[model samples]
Target: MTSHYDWRGGREAMMRFGLADAPVVVIAPPPFEEANRLRALMATVARGLARQGLAAVIPDLPGTGESLTDIAATRLADWRDAFAAANEAAGPVRLIASVRAGALFDGGQGAVGHWRLTPQDGSRLLRELVRTRIAGLREDGREASSATLTEIARNDGIELSGHWFTPALFGDLEEAAPLPAHPLRTVRLDGDAQPADHRLAAAPLWRRAEPGNDLELAQLVADDIADWMRTCLGG
Candidate 1:
């Protein structure tokens, strides 16, 4: 359920929870359409964590979810601010974030799913996201005609989920980063060259999902989270 509480002097923080005293964890939702696709997985993680004696807070950062804020008005600073508030309300918690939000670690713990690409690469990824979305919308179905895919990949005004995305959104997403060099066990989803920015360790939680995987990917994520909590807090 949803409840409002004073976070940092009457800021009126709104959040959903599974239970209290379960080693609070904040699960950051993904961006755009993936947010919709991954809602089930996100909730699964939260509930799984709760079952393992961990409290989970899954808040819609400023512009997302049931947040009363507009997406257009949300800035990077605002996101970080919301994170800080969530951390405060939840108390010294480990973050289970998706996409850019995973970059918040202090580079001290093992990061599960995260990436750090340059602005150009990030922009490219955003454009590809736009392209895939447009392709998904066409009557031709998910398998876009090569020509249409190429065209969307190359230019502006590409439709994303039935709406045109301006260059501005891509520009902003490009500059975003989850600063802090937290100790990590990163799962590079795209198979990009490993970076020296964060240490490499085994990350089974974020490996590719097959047609009939043994355990649900979200459950694996939750398991790793519980492991982290145990290691850090003698649970």
Candidate 2:
């Protein structure tokens, strides 16, 4: 079902699953383009959780999804506060399930536990965006590098892909890292060498050129979350 939650900025849309009174898992989706790629997978996971008798919500942060806010004006702090507010509105939220860059703002919500899938730091994300921009410029017979684009971003702002990133947002991202929450469980795909509590054997859906769904991977993720939530709830 679709619901709305009011934050300090304004109200934003969110998708809810399962019974209204059940313990909830608030999902913090990956930032920007990655979010679009994984939307289907996230929805599938949310529904799977519902089948396990748990509630879940996927909120649209300030400048993302169906939000009315301007992306160029949104900052990292705004996203963090908005995420915290969303969690408060989702009744009885027991945990947060975040993917990639989503982990950066999953804290400050007071959730008992956090489950992240291949969490990524802001610097790395920024670099990826910069690289993409440079690639586009090269195809047009133009010259630009990460350092040059970053300098432009610092002085004014830069448009990477379709999003306009403000100087403040770029600066914030340069120093942002995923919050180290207590009782956190990090999961990664099999090929990733990064340390994780668990690793699944599935291709990264976010890497696909188009949005896709992986029912098998979604089920694995949902089951892991259900088991983790049970442990966190002392069951």
Candidate 3:
């Protein structure tokens, strides 16, 4: 049975399955458009894990997914703390963190089971962050000049949306550490293991579109999660 519970500045919604005592898979969601895009995939993976005798909790971190916080007020530390709280609620947890969320495991934080999909390149992510911030400002009817954008990027106290953009978040992100030295399994995008250090557990990258359009990327992400659970849980 799937149920919802309020948790740490947010609500934790989860589905339970099989032996009431099974270990849990707590899924930490990705961010922004990616979260919506990957929702189905996360659900599929949760269900798949449940079928295999593992319970799963897929919560919308404090600000995302019907939670109290919106995109603007959601900060990186808030997400990290949310994951930790979710793990506590789920009991001994194996975490499936996707995209940018994968970075949370860097400092050996609340990690039990770790899995990542399409791990982001942190530097590129920062660049894209700038673009996103600028575009968001424009969309909000705020005049965004190149100078303004540069100033925002340089400052750590600027408010984008409602959250304070801090240099610490960017620094930690840029330093993208190795998956906390713990037992971790990963599946990468459709490419050979570029990171020679960690061998990818799965190589197939599912597609939601025929051959183009990034909008279809969500389908691929969802499929990837579903496939990973099916293979890992033998469901």
Candidate 4:
């Protein structure tokens, strides 16, 4: 079902699935372009969770998804606060499921447990975006270096891909890292060297050049989340 939640900024859309009285799992989607790439897969996972009798919600944070907020005006703090507000509205959220950069803001929701998939820090995400921007510039016969772009972002803000990021948002992202939450379960792709509570053999959908879906991977994620929720809920 589609619903809206009100935060200090305003109302944003949220998609809910599964039994209304079931345990709730709030999904914090990956930021920016990765969010687009992973959208279908996330929705699939939500549906799978629904089939397992878990209520899953994916909220549209301010400046992302179908939101009225201007991207340039949004700060990381706004996302965190909005996510917390969304959690409050989601009705006793038992777990937070976050992927990649989503981990950065998932902690403020106060869920009983957090499940992260290959969580990434802001600096690395910025670097990847800068590289993509530089590549686009090179293709356009313009030149820009990472250091120069970083300086520009720090002072005057900058546009990456299609999103306009303010200096405050840029600075916030540069220093942002995933917050530590108790009963955290980290999942990574099989080959990733990062520490994770579990590793699954699945391709990184967020890195794809085009948006796609993998039902198998989504089912795996849903199953893992179901198990984690069971443990977190003492079931």
Candidate 5:
């Protein structure tokens, strides 16, 4: 069962798979422009976790999704505050995050375990963002390059691809730290295979002009995550 409420000043859209006693896993959604493509998947995964008898709390990042904050004024520290607030309201739990770009914010400190899906380092993600932006502009009949976009957003700000792209924010995205070392449970629902290969071969859904929620793929991801959690922590 899912419910909505406010906690620690952040409005949370939660799905309690079962009960409060059930173990919880705070989900960190993908950050920035790609968030829309992954939000449904995150919610679906929460339902799947609930079916496996776990609770999931998904908090809207400070500057995104139902948040009462301005994206332009928001900084990484604000995101951290919202996440920490979710932690306070969530009680004891684990951390399970999907979408590689958001890995920088997971913190991974107090959780009993970490389950990251499609994790990528910051440098790679930032490079892709730049390329994607430039390509998008070119397609729009405007011959904008990475250097140009970087310069523009770096100077003021630009609204493209549903994000208020900014130079300062891009720098933060570039500086995101890597995940905590292994023995930290991680998985890749898509991308590559090799049992535990975490390399992502497919492009992000957010790149699509009209991103579709592939329910089939979402379900598959949910099932895999639930099974992994059950095995690792037991129901």
Candidate 6:
């Protein structure tokens, strides 16, 4: 079931699954539009974890999703602490489950390992977000440069695409790179893995034009994640 609790100067929401136990993999969310696209899949992953006799918590990272708090006040540290809170709520984190740019915030603070999905370098993700927003502005007949979209947060603090990014958040994202700390247990590549023939090489789910809950795709990905988690935790 989904639950909410005080976390990192805001309340974070998470969907808890099966025989809640210690050392959960707190699933760090992808930021902005990506989060909207991947939310269903993430929940499916938690359900898969339960089926595997493991517990997982898919958190609504601070300033996003159900926690619509002061997004402008949010920062990298707040996200890290939120991870810890989710871990504490479940116990020690066996793994920090992260998706896409979300891997940028993996604290590795108290985790035994990490599990990353569609892993992306931080700076690249930020640039992608900027590009996406810029294209969006063009569609609206607004000629906005990536520079303006990138720094407008410092001025208007407006919602870009779907979520708010404050100046502080913008700076952190611009500087983010692959996490330098955590030793990952697994990285499930979807569409990024080799050989175009691979099943995981399907079109990116998070980039879908229309919002969808691809339960079939979600379950397939979830089962894959569960299998990897099992391997990481040792069969």
lDDT of 2 by residue, 141-229 (tens): 99998998999999999898688899999999999999888898999999998999999999999878778899999999999999999
lDDT per prediction? 0.51, 0.92, 0.53, 0.91, 0.64, 0.70
Per-model TM values vs. the true structure: 0.64, 0.97, 0.61, 0.97, 0.79, 0.83
- In terms of lDDT, which candidate is stronger, 5 or 6? 6
lDDT of 6 by residue, 70-189 (tens): 777888778877866776666554667777788777664666666666667656777777788788878899898777766676666656677677777777777777576444644454
In every candidate, how many clashes are there? 12, 0, 4, 0, 1, 0
- TM-score-sorted candidate list, best first: 4, 2, 6, 5, 1, 3
lDDT by residue (tens digit), candidate 3, 59-127: 566656666565445556666666666566665534454554444532225545455655565554555
lDDT per residue for candidate 5 within 35-99, as digits (tens), equals 77676667776777777777777767766886676788766666665665665567565645545
Q: How close is candidate 5 to the true structure, as a TM-score?
A: 0.79
lDDT per residue (tens digit) for residues 1-235 in model 4 = 8998899999999999998888899999988989889999999999999999899999999998889999878999999989888887887656998999999999655587889999999999999999999999999999999999999999999988778889999999999999788889999998898898999989988888988998889999999999999999888
* lDDT value, candidate 3, whole model: 0.53
Best by the lDDT measure: 2
**Where is model 5 more than 4 Å wrong at Cα?**
1-17, 181-183, 189-209
**Deviation from native of the Cα of residue 91 in model 5, angstroms:** 3.0
Superposed model 3: Cα runs more than 4 Å off? 1-19, 70-73, 93-100, 105-112, 121-123, 132-150, 153-179, 196-235
Output the better candidate (1/6) by lDDT: 6
CA displacement after TM-score superposition, residue 41 of candidate 6 (Å):
1.2
Q: Which ten residues in a row have the lowest lDDT in candidate 1?
A: 111-120
Give the higher-TM-score candidate: 3 or 5: 5
